[model samples]
Each structure stands twice: as C-alpha cells, then as structure tokens.
Target: MRGLVTFEGGEGAGKTSQIRRLAQRLTEQGETVVLTREPGGSVGAELIRELILGGTGQFDPLAEALLFAAARADHVRKKIKPAIESGSIVLCDRFYDSTKAYQGAGSTVPAGVIAQLTQIAAGDSRPDITFILDIDPKIGIARAGRRNLASSVSADRFEIEGLEFHKRVREGFLAIAAAEPDRCVVIDASRDVDDVASQIWLALEAAKPRFMRNAPQIRLDPKTDALVDDFAQAMKAKLLASQVKYGCSDDWLVDDWEGECQAELANHVQKGDPRDVANYAAFCWGRGWRASPAA
Candidate 1:
C-alpha cells in the first residue's frame, strides 16, 4: 500500500485535523501510514523549518523559496522516499504546492522558476494525490487568529500575513488544482470537519486500491521515447500549423489549449501506458509563454 497523499491550503483550512483523521482511519485499516509535514519532516529539515517559520532569519520571499527547496530535498532523501519505498501509505499535511502557492503564484517569484526548483528537489517523485482545502480568506484568517490565541505557538510569518496574501494563496492553490485535476482534489473546507473528512475518505477509498495494487515505477525504453518524441513533435507542429492557418503573429499562441492537452493526457493515463503518460505530462507542462532573453 505504498503511496503519498498531501493536504494543502491556507492557514486555518483544517488541513491538520483532516489529515490526522484520515491517517487514523487508514491506520485502522491495517495500513502502515507515515504521517508527516513540510517544510520540516526530517531532522535537518526541521532546523531549516525553524529558521524559516520562527522568523529568526526573516528571509526574503526568494531566499525563503530556496530554503524550502533545500529542506524539501533533505526531507525527500531522508524520510519520504524511504517510507514510500518501504510500502508505507504516507500522508503529508503540506508539500510542494505550499511553496507554489505562497512563494510562486502569490509572490514575486516566477512560477516557472519555482517549478524548476521543485523538480530539482524531488526529482520525478510527485504526490500520488493532493487535496486542496478551499475556504474564504476572511473566515480563514479569523480562524487562524483564534487558533494562535488558543495554542502554545504564536502566529508565524505566513500565519501573520494579511488578508490579500491569503486571498492570493487561495487563488494560487485553485489554479494548481485546475491545472492538474487528476492529481489534485479540491474540497470545500467551509464545510464541517465530518463532511469534509467523509468526502476525503471517499476519494481515498477510490484511489488507494489502484495505488496499492498496481503502482510501479515506470521506465521507458528507447523505442518508447522515440515514439513519444514523435508524438510531441507532431503536437507542436500541429499547433504551429494552426497559427499559420489562422494567420497569427510569431509571438502568438493558442488562447485555450488546455482542453486538448488534458484530453491527451487523460487518454494516455486511461490506456495505462506510463511512457506515453510521462511524455504527455512533460509536453503539457511546457505550455504557455516560455522565457526568451531579448537582444
């Protein structure tokens, strides 16, 4: 029953409580669950976590992003990778999407660069499923304040942030969920804990069996790579031809290619062709405006 599931949201989204509940239920089902969180799951990572969260360092957004990447690299090497390799069902309170929301889309950092940093940190390892808890920023902020007032710990940098920041983070999370619908599930955190947990359980029950029964690390052969390359090139060429057909400018691109992209990825995924799936994902990820230095 080896797999990884991550819960992500703004502060006061009840991610911690919901994750704990899910972990307890799964453990009772006789699964070995490795419950953890980021940016500090491993010991070394915890040190970094304190430096970031405790506000001792008070680093800028970019520096904080780098620190997070470092901590995540260590966490993956020391804890997450090992647990999953041992066939444990790993439930994480937060993961890469936190960085993506807080530091990337919600901040000044380029989302592409953050995406690259994440790739470097975790390699090809990605969460098998991610749950994004959606809630109103106003209610969420008040809830977080009350939590801080009640708990032993005070509000850290992120929790101390203003309403606008929380709103942006929520939008960032929603964007991620929209971009990767298959890999992410968005639940309305405004609902009561029981209802949210029930929805989460339904999602888990549907997906866990597939992961446990058939999850395997896929490696593509040279022939498969070539075929995928051809397919990708063909897609690109078709898009280019479409531009010519429509008499578009050189800098112009499709306004809404996501539907086609999603359909293609879903096709490969449904066919259970891992090589094709990997290729399709890689191609789709490279979509949108690419960086090009001007002369």
Candidate 2:
C-alpha cells in the first residue's frame, strides 16, 4: 500500500472540511487521493455503525469497542487497504485512536484491551501520518449540535457525550500524539478551517521524506484480518510459550528474534529497530505457521 494518513479530533473539529480541502489540494498536485471515514465507511461497517451510533444505546462500552473494531476490520480490510495498496493518497477521518479516547479514556474499558482489539481488527495497518486536531469540547459540541440540526438528525452516540467526556477525549488524543511523535502531529483545531488546512498541508510536505523512503505498499494486508486475528488472539502468550517450547530464553527472544528469522521475512519487516521477531513469529504461528530448520 501507499501512504496512509488519518484525521482525529472531537466532533465538529473541522476534520471533514480539512480532509476535503487536503484531498483536493493533493489531487491538484497530481496525486490520487482516496478520502474515507470510519465506523461507516464500507457497507458492512456502516450497518454495524447504525447499531452503535443509533439512539438505542444497547451497546455497552466494551460492546461499543468491539463493534467499532468489527466495523474497522471491514473498513480497513475492504476500503482503506485497497486504496493504500493501489498507491493512492488515503486520508481517513477517524481510526483506532478514537476508540482509545472514547471507550478507553472516556469510559470504563482499559487501554490495553483497546490496543489488543485494534490489532485484531486493524492488523498492523497504521497511518504514516496522524494529525490530531486539538480543540476545546465546549466550542466543538456547540458546532456539532449545529451540524446535527442542519443535517436533520440527533447527535450520534459519541458526539452526544457530556463535556467532561469530550475533555478526556481531547487529552487522550494529545497523549497519543505525544507518545508517538514520529508518527503523530497535533494541530490546533480551534483555528480557522483554512488555517487548519494549511498546517496539515505543511505537515504532509514535512512527512514526504519518510513516507517516500518506505516501500510502495506501506500497509495493505495480503489476506483477511480474521485469518490474522485467529492466530493473534493469544499472540503474546503464545510467544512466551514458544520460548519454552523452542528452548529459547525469554531474553533471547526478547533481544534477538530478529537475528533468528528467515531472511525473506527479515527484509519485509516494519516496526522499530531490532524488531521483535518473537512477536512476528507468534503472528506467523497464529496463521498456521511452523518453525523452519533455519529459524
């Protein structure tokens, strides 16, 4: 896949407008842009989203997270993945981070649970650049209310969350961006739309070096996410078990799984330097893999 970018913010943070302007700007510069949104991007995901954002409120926090993950699995697997694979400039409205904020921080769900679930639903497909639009919830909620009035619909489940919830969501976004400075950039969403778009464009320009240096298909999955998740359900535990089964020390796998991998998988690996080969191997094992003699 090509480059992936996502816009994250509270409701009415001008993500829609900024995404549109950026898509148009990039298209004018002779790039193919595929603009999409989450929770309701693809057909299957949209259906799940109705149950989620519809007024029923039957879904609890954990259920909401699962539903979002299920929808995300479809959206990324069917829509976002294909666009990225085709080398299009893919811009997504919201991604996994929203769950971290809304469900994890704003409610009773755990962040680690959200992380693990995101892996199952999203695989390893992460954005090349993530722009978190920072804004106050008070102004944002009013804007969202106005938007709902114009659209002739009530505020959605997340949009209708109270002020404190939105504040926690904002702080969550900032924390994420701060934690992953290389992949995330925070911008003031309280600014004018044009001003916000300009910052986004500048950041896009700034990220070109790293983005262009990577492989063509940065994050497209070759197979189904279900196939990936079935194996990854107990991925960490499985890896620890593999250490005992294979007579490799925890320290050995922790420190040198990269050095232990087949050369082919080695060349294709992404993630941090000294990539966790044990984790990757666990991922492979989940997909019905076995250890090679060389490994």
Candidate 3:
C-alpha cells in the first residue's frame, strides 16, 4: 500500500529540511505520512545513535559499522517496516546508503563488509524511492558549520570530518545513484530551498502512479481503530487454535505470531475498501461468521 522514501547526501545537503517539506506536501494531499530518520527511529535505535554519534572516533571502523548496523536493525524492524505495512508513506532522512557512503567510502571499512551488514540490518525492506541531493562538499560543510554555529550546537562526527572526507562521502553517494538508477534520483541541492523542494516534488509526482497511488483509503475513526484491535485479537486467537489443532510446533512462528497476525490484518485493512474489515472478520472466523448487512 504505502512506500518508503529516503533522502541521502553529504553533511548539510538539507535532507532533513527536504523531508519536512515532502511530508507536509504529502499530508496536505491526504496521505498518511510517517516521517522518521535513520540511526534513531525506534527507542533502541536512538540509544545506539547517541552511542555512535557521540563516541565518534572512539569506535574503530569495524566497530562503528557494527554499531550502525545494530541500530538500523532495530529501526527497520520496530519502525520503518511497520509504518509502510500499515499504509503510511514513510519519509526517512537517511537509510542504508548513508552507511555505505560514510562507513565504507569515507572510512576504512570494506565495501563488501558494509553491503553484508546492510543486508543483515535492513533485510528485504528497501526504499521505494531515494532522493540523493547533490552538493559540493565545500558548500555543504560550510552550510553545516553555519547552521551548527547558529543553533549553538556542536558538529556531529560526520559533520566535523575534514573537507576531503566529505568529498569522499559525496562521491560515494553519486556512485550509488549511478549503480541504482531505477531507485535513486539525484537532485541538485546547492540551489535555494524552494528550488530543491520543487525538484524533489517533481520526482515524487513522477513516481506517484507506481509507488504512491495504491495506498488504501484509510478512514480511521475511533470506532474503526477499535474494530482493528478487535479483529486483530480474533485473528490471533484463530491462528493459535489452528496451530494447536494441526500439531504445529514452529517455535519461532508461535513466538512471533503477534507480528504475523498484525501484518495480515494490515494487508487486509489496505485492500482499498473501507468495508474490508468486515470481510476480514469472515476470513478469520470462517464460514460460520458473517458481517451484518449494514457492515
């Protein structure tokens, strides 16, 4: 139903600002938008983000990469995956590409190592579209410096890196865009805010038919929310009963049934019809169950 869109670039490429604008525009268009950022989307990931960013040079290249992968694993499982499955357009400030660029290209970590770790962390969840805002490292770092000074905040680890390091980071992003042309859109980010936003919007509009148009029409009133909860519990109970009756002993499936059931509920809820919940009830409870005619 909904898709994940990520933004990536060097320091001060304005990924956060552009994400804000995109979320606002999408929300105004009646989309259910969940705005999140890498390294800190979930509670566990935020703690890891603080550890990684603040520790900075304390962690060696391999250790740092591992930390980032750990955080991403938590973020993807707890936040990003759920939002998209629930039919919310997820706009993330950064994602795995940043890891490859910063930890692989900008540091001593091997590209192969980064790729393997990214697979472990992100699994099958990848952005439907990625906007790579391109800018000169000199311009970006200067902008970052100015913003940090204005906000009375110290530069983060990546921002405080030397100009040459940032240049490597920029090259990394461009190379990614080159390799993954179908999923990556490189935008000129040296221009003013409005110009950058305009380009980003145009790209999103171009992608709408394929990526954004199929989201279920969610009429989420309080009653509907409650109905979702009720159906969820019913389906979970049914799943448990079926497993027991069939003498199934997949411990992992039993342990993680809540997530499985919720995913199924989300899939049904996004079937594009509001009355799909009524259908869901019948599906879960089988032949004996029927929706009221009014339902």
Candidate 4:
C-alpha cells in the first residue's frame, strides 16, 4: 500500500531524523519507501530550492509563496506521484503545508492565495498522514543554529529569520493541525528523541491500516502486465527444464515449481516493483537457474 506521509514543523523540529526512523521501520516491514523533501525532490524543484534557500530577501512574501508552489508542482508531478504509483510509501520532509505555514502565516501571503496555489500544484496528491513536530520556536531555532554551525552549513533564508517569524511559523503549523485533526498528528518534539519517535510510530501504526484500506488498488499498465506475463512463462520454462535436467526429480516437482513461480510473480506484480520483476527474469535466464547440483 502506497502512502504519502509528510512532516511539518518549525525549524529543527527533528523532522529529518524521525522521517528516517519511520522509513527504516516501514522498509523492515517490506514496504518500498521513498524519502524526499519539498522545495526539492525533483530536479527542477531542487534548482528552485537552491534559488529560494540560497538567497536572502530576494523574493517578496507572495513571490516566495509562488516559488514554493512552482517547486511543489514539479516535485509532485515528477517524484511524488511516480513513487506512489510504483507502490512506494513516500515519506516527505515537507509538503504544501510548509507553504501554508511559512509563506502564509509566517509572512504576508493570504491564506486563500496559499490554498489556491497549493491545490494547483499538489493536485490530488495530498498526504495520507502529516506529523507536526511541535516545538518552542526559540528552542527549535537554537537547535537549527547549532546544527548549521556543527555541519559548517550556513543558515538558509528561513533559518535566518527572527524569533517572531519562527514563532509565527510554529503557530501556523499548530493551527493547521487543529483545523485538520484527522489528517495531522501533533508530536511534542521537545521531548526526548526516543519518546517523540515512539509517539510518531504509535500514531502511524494506528493510522496505516486505515490508509491502506482506503488506498487505490494497484493498477499496472499494459506494458508492465505484458512484461510480467513474459517473465512468468520464461520462469516456468526454466524451472521445468531444470527439473528435467536433474532426472531424479519427482513427477510433481515441475508442477510445484510452476505454482511457486506464479505465486512469486503475483507477489511481485502486486508490489508494483517492475525492477524486481526484471531482476527475477534475469536471475532465471542466467546460469544461476541451471547451475544447481543434482538433488
């Protein structure tokens, strides 16, 4: 089941760390996870990230909102949408909610304008769940500053903003969470890292089943279906040939092999990992399929 999970908060709210932890957990459960960030993710969006984050006071509030929306449009179309279609759970660092918080509340941009831009850019790719890592603006800023200094990375445009700006951003996120209780989970990020992560995981565990149940069924393109079918036939042939080669095979061995092959093919196709299907085909075509010692 593919899901779009987003993390939103003020600066240094531990979004990166928590996102990684969640991704690892999901991956361990055999989910295909795509970790990405907004203002970036796609190539064009990344260029916009460099332009927007690298420059200070270059864009007015409305312009900044527009820039973010433009980047988000590219990101959704190029990266987020494709990954979801391919059955990958996309864990995003930020999404349009950042535009609503930073550009709308933290700046002079109107909420209506921000919403319009977000809808246009994001289309139907709304997040399945959003984690608002709430923290005091001052503490978050200090943490961001220390992180930048330690990594020898200069403060980006928003990181350089004053305390009042960050405070507004924090409030913005909180307001969003309150407005959309069903979609958002506000995590108290001031707690210990493990505590915060535990809260997040618990919330995710509770919500994931519902999201998966509501997720659209996996649909394969004609080309992909054809590829899967071809691989299925080829794998069956290879397994039968191997059984014949090893003359001591039981009469039902080839039937068992075919059933197993079909099961694997169904699993791979349902997961929508075309690469896995191709790799399986390659494995069966190579010497590995026939190099086994007699059993």
Prediction RMSDs, each to the true structure: 13.6, 13.3, 12.6, 9.5
TM-score for all predictions?
0.72, 0.72, 0.72, 0.74
Predicted candidate 1 versus true structure: per-residue lDDT over 211-270, tens digit per residue: 633234446677787876676566555544544665454333344444444444444544
lDDT of 4 by residue, 1-295 (tens): 5779999999999999999998898888777899999889999999999999999978999998999999999999999989987778899999999999999899999999998998999999989999999999889999999999999999999999999999999899999999999999999999999999999999987675445333443345777887776865565555556545654334323333333333444345445355554554353333123232346
Superposed model 1: Cα runs more than 4 Å off: 213-295
Off by over 4 Å in 2: 217-295
Better of 2 and 4 by lDDT: 4
lDDT leader? 4
Model 1 residue 178 CA deviation in Å: 0.4
Residue 289 CA error for candidate 3 (Å)? 31
Give the top-scoring candidate (TM-score).
Answer: 4
TM-score (C-alpha) between model 4 and the true structure: 0.74
Candidate 4 pairs with clashing backbones: none
Residue-by-residue lDDT tens digits, candidate 2, 204-242: 877764554333321327675555555444554554455
Give the lDDT of residue 200 in candidate 1.
96
- The ten-residue window of minimal lDDT in model 4 covers 283-292
Going through the candidates in the order shown, the clash numbers are 0, 3, 0, 0
Q: How do the residues 79-184 of candidate 3 rate in per-residue lDDT, one tens digit apiece?
A: 9988887778899989999998998888899999998999999999888899999999999989999999999988887787888898888999999999999899
lDDT (Cα atoms) of all candidates against the true structure: 0.79, 0.76, 0.79, 0.81
